[model samples]
Target: MFAFCADPKTLEGAAWFACYLTSATHLAMYWSVLTVMLLLALAAPSALMFGFGGALMARSHIPPLAWVGKGYISMVRGVPDIVFFLFVPIAVDQGLEYLMHVTRCADWTEPVRRGADFVVCPQAKIPQSTAPAYVHDAYAFALALLAFALVFGAFAANTLKGAMEAVPRAQVETAEAYGMNRAQAFRRIILPQMWVYALPGLTNLWMILVKATPLLFLLGIQDIVYWARELGGSKTQVYAYPHPDWRVWYFLALLVFYLGLTWASERVFARVQNRLSVGQATAAGEALRKAGAA
Candidate 1:
């Protein structure tokens, strides 16, 4: 970036360091931080959608729907998250391929399971073997996003369901007494009040989600952790700006990045909670009311 950076091989000290950090590979490395942030930003809302559906299903009047929702939430809770992180994408991928195979290869009678192998028609391959590199990367990212959403959604569903139930029975009863039906009471009374109760758990889930971004490396996504490992290793003299083993420093920078992310998220969530609590009967709202009067 600077005049001295014109000859990276001959430069030393701060000059070489500056040029090294500005290299194309390092630029991609920097961009990977944004990728992590984007993943979180996208995943949070998607997970909330999944959680809302799951929570609603759990509360469904239909016995089978309730069982499915309850089972989804409970099964995920007992399993190690890492296991699901690994399993979900592969399972989803294969399931998609299997459905495609059945439809696209209707005349074929080959069993999908041949011992350890999963055989499917070439047309059934996700992204297809002929697709470009970027398409493959996008496919992988989509799967990763789904895995994140599904895992976190289960936790969110449990929290939301509990929060829904925690809304006072008296409040719902009064709404009904005032001629509101179950659906009306839920929409006007229960849904509005549940946020305050759910905020604490949802905030904790956000922190967990932030920490879990590193696991993207395991899923073959070139996230910040992957870039750190790549750029922080020792470089040879053949490279323009050779360096020593700097993995420790790279990982340290990542640590700071995550710490800052969590700290900022905490501040934002706290502000949101305060805003949502205003005029509510919660302890925080009550306290705020008293303090404002004083």
Candidate 2:
């Protein structure tokens, strides 16, 4: 950024390093960090919503709805996540395209599936074939987000189902005795208490999600790992900055980044669990009350 950075080839040592770090590619790499953060920020809430819905579905009185919820959780838990990571995007993408094809390509007489290829009308293409780079990136990030949400949401559903079931039978009876209807009892007694039971499992899911960000590379997103590998790869004398393979150092930075994220997540979850445990009958609540008295 300095005036001397005008001619990077003439610079060496710290000056060369500073100019290199501030280059366009490096700036893109830095922005990719935010992309990871954006994914987490969006994915966490989306996954939670899906999980909540799934839990309620499984607990529903309707047999069909309960089957779907339990099936989703079972499918996720039974299968390896990488299978979903690889399959979900393709499935979702084609599903959208196929739906559009049926509507938009209704006049066309061509079959969508021939042999190994699945073809769709150009109009049915997501973002079309000629959209800007950012739109494509956004689309890919969205797919990755969906896959993460699906996998994590299934696990969350299981956690929440257990938590919901864990609410004491006596608690519900007591609420009913106090003239509370089923819905009122659920709102006042079940919903408020389930979090204390669910937090531990949910916290673990968050950490796994944090670590799982690296799998974005598999989903065609230019996440931090991709950038680190690209930037830290050795460049020859033909390039502006020639250096040895520094991927190890780049990966080390990623290590530090993930560690920091995990540590912060743990602290946040601990505080949440503590706050939720404040007045409950759980062991943790008792400990908190005793600590308060002391």
Candidate 3:
């Protein structure tokens, strides 16, 4: 920000525009881009971990565990994702508070759910009623992250399960012939090989996750979509910065942002896919071999 930014009202043309853009609200809007990035950064790994666990469970010998894993994947696939996004935060929040309420409000016997209202004692409030605004925002963001992880993890689980099955049955038998147990064979042969099969599905999931970031607005997070609407809406002369509706321009920027992210992701995945195919039996591997010989 320059000295000229001191009096936005006095400035005109480019100067006025610069001062307005650098204003507090606009800075917050700019920061919303980082919020979207943070969600992706945090959510991706968390979702992957969840997916890995689900996939492993689904592959387990134990019937109960396998059932749970299969059920999770099936349920998530069967349901709409927006339903999960809306339901999870409220459900998790209430579940946490209910546990706290049982412990903290044992003596207070008013019904927590009386017909339409769900009430918890003040002490059981997440971040407490008196906490700072940032704490509230952080908590909401965390809930949104968890919801994203759970939903995407199911899809990831399905992808991983399929990949695991796609590994050659001969490879497992070969490992056994070499005196390797199930666990050893899985770690040494299956795990390494399955990733190639999984990469395409995972790449697609990443793109879907990138597009899904806009749903953060539903979770009360001040994401880029929310900022675009807020900042691009028309403001009158009564406001310090008055502007006409430029929502089309704002959304165009978001469209470009998502496109850029997807393009980069595709390039990265293509490189990874080629690298993984280097010594495999697939067509890609044969091409790579031919290319090397040439």
| Most TM-score-accurate candidate | 3
What's the lDDT for all of these models?
0.92, 0.93, 0.92
TM per prediction:
0.93, 0.96, 0.97
Could you report the Cα RMSD, in angstroms, for every candidate shown?
1.9, 1.3, 1.1
* TM-score attained by model 2: 0.96
lDDT of 2: 0.93
Error of 2 at 284 (Å): 1.2
Q: Write the per-residue lDDT of candidate 2 for residues 1-294, one digit (tens) a residue.
A: 678888778999999999999888889889999999998999889999999999999999999999999999999989999999999999999999999999998998889998999998899999787999999998998899999999999999999999998989899999999999988998999999999999999999998898899899999988899999998999998987789999999999999999998888999999999999999999999999999999
Candidate 3 segments whose C-alpha is farther than 4 A from its true place: none
1-294, model 3: which lDDT tens digit per residue? 779787667889998988888888889988888899999999999999989999999999999999999999999989999999999999999999999999998897899999888899998888798999999989999999999999999999999999999999999999999999999999999899898999999999999999999999989887888888988999998888888998899899999999998999899999999999989988888999999999
Candidate 1 per-residue C-alpha lDDT over 93-161 given as tens digits, one digit per residue, 9 for 90 to 100: 999999999889888788989999998999888879999998998899999999999999999999999
Poorest stretch of ten by lDDT in candidate 3: 1-10
Preferred candidate (TM-score higher): 2 or 3: 3
